[model samples]
Target: MNEMGKTDTVVQPQSSLLELKKMFFLYLPVCIGGYIVFRVLIVLPLWFSSSTEQLSVLRIIFIILGVGALAVVVLGAVRAPRWVEKPIHVHYRHWAPAFFATLVILGSIGGHLVASAKINSNLALEKVKAHFEKETAEYKMGRNAQ
Candidate 1:
């Protein structure tokens, strides 16, 4: 109590970097666990029961995990200030993990695009090869008839 009969309190300043590290340590594991559970419980069984390739399932899972991590990091960045009641500094160490994850997500997207293009180009080459073979066969047959 003070002379005026009112209680006083002192608030300590909080570190935003520490809070951000804690958020990453907390949320990343949860996202990884969800990814594993989804892959094992849902995708694995369906994959085994089906008779075709499951490459697309792996791609879908990667996409879901990437989006989930991106969302989590974005939410954390937005809400951290509200929790700390102060502006966050633009420090590389503070945001490195989120940046790395974002980079990985972008790399995976690029890889998928490259793979799709290669597959499409291969299909086109096969089509051209088939047409060439058909033309040569027709030429041979017409020459023999003449």
Candidate 2:
């Protein structure tokens, strides 16, 4: 107590907290973008290119990176209101960045899914055709020799 009823308090340095928050707000988008690239572009390709024996390990790494990136982006978005300032005029400009990023993310995932499905379907069709051809060849060879 310092005065008749007021409590005494020590002065606190606000610069550190202010600086940390400033850094976070400034680099928030960059961090999210980098993580997205690492997760989708780099980690995913590495996982897909890995051999069967090493696939599991790479898969785990991909999953971890993906989850971490998602978490970071989500957290940043959730906390955006804390640091982001809105303009006096209403416009689509505010939402454009997030919208485009989301569009790219969805497009990439959808493209990957469709491409993988097509490749697998083609592989299966090739297998079926090969099986039929092998059966016909074996039958013809046996009959001709007899």
Every model's TM-score: 0.46, 0.42
Task: Give one digit per residue, the lDDT tens place, for model 2 in 64-108.
Answer: 544554555565466454233432111233333444454345534
Poorest 10 consecutive residues by lDDT, candidate 2: 87-96
> How do the residues 1-146 of candidate 1 rate in per-residue lDDT, one tens digit apiece?
88999888776655877757766676666456545543453333233422112344545655776687687568647644343444343233345456555655554565445434444565688899999999999999999999
The local lDDT score (0 to 100) that residue 106 gets in candidate 2 is 51
The TM-score leader among the candidates is 1
Instruction: Identify the candidate with maximal lDDT.
Output: 1
Residue pairs in collision within model 2: none
lDDT (Cα atoms) of all candidates against the true structure: 0.56, 0.52
Question: Model 1's lDDT to the true fold?
Answer: 0.56
Q: Which stretches of candidate 2 lie over 4 Å from their true place?
A: 1-85, 88-92
Worst 10 residues of 1 by lDDT: 44-53
